[model samples]
Target: MSNWSIDAGVICFSGVLDRFTVPDLWASLSSWKPTEKGYLVDLSRVERVDSAGMVMLIHLLEHAKTENCHIMLSFVPKDLGTLFRLSNVDKLLAKHIQN
Candidate 1:
């Protein structure tokens, strides 16, 4: 199972982020509106991630764009970073990722 919390304009995620978990998380966040112009997404505690998780991250970025907000992802897992590079999507998300 996976879960997320927001504090001080940062969204922190923990546990596994896969196909099963992404659906519920996505549903919950779909209607969320950001109150800040800039936000940070901290994934350092996330144990694992799959393609679905990557897709969800992209969707979150798009959602933020629609709201005229910007979200930077921080502490991305090594494996997920590899997946992004292998999938050739690293460039697309590079500007939004913070090492």
Candidate 2:
């Protein structure tokens, strides 16, 4: 199971972002508007992900960029960091790098 929460400039998520998790992603994305500042998604709680989850994040990034907003990922696990590196999004998201 997976869940998420969002407030003006931040979006926090914990759980899987796989095929079954797309709905959560959509719900989060659709909540944003062009006028919004941006997003900082906390993926530290998410234990796992599949391609669908990656796609969801990519789409959110596209939306954020097109809207002239920034999207960040916080506390990414090591395994997922590798995935982000392979996907060429290492610097784009987890620029915060607190952990």
Candidate 2 lDDT, 23-69, residue by residue in tens: 76688676677556667778879888876787787787777778888
For each candidate, the alpha-carbon lDDT, in order, equals: 0.95, 0.74
Q: Compute the lDDT of residue 85 as modeled in candidate 1.
A: 96
Model 2: ten consecutive residues of lowest lDDT:
90-99
**What's the residue-level lDDT of 43 in candidate 2?**
86
The superposed Cα distance between candidate 2 and the true structure at residue 62, in angstroms, equals 0.6
C-alpha lDDT of residue 82 in model 1 = 90
Say which candidate scores most in TM-score: 1
RMSD of each: 0.6, 2.8
Q: Tens digits of per-residue lDDT for model 1 on 31-94?
A: 8899999899999999999999999999999999999999999999998999899899999999
Q: At residue 46, what lDDT does model 1 achieve?
A: 98
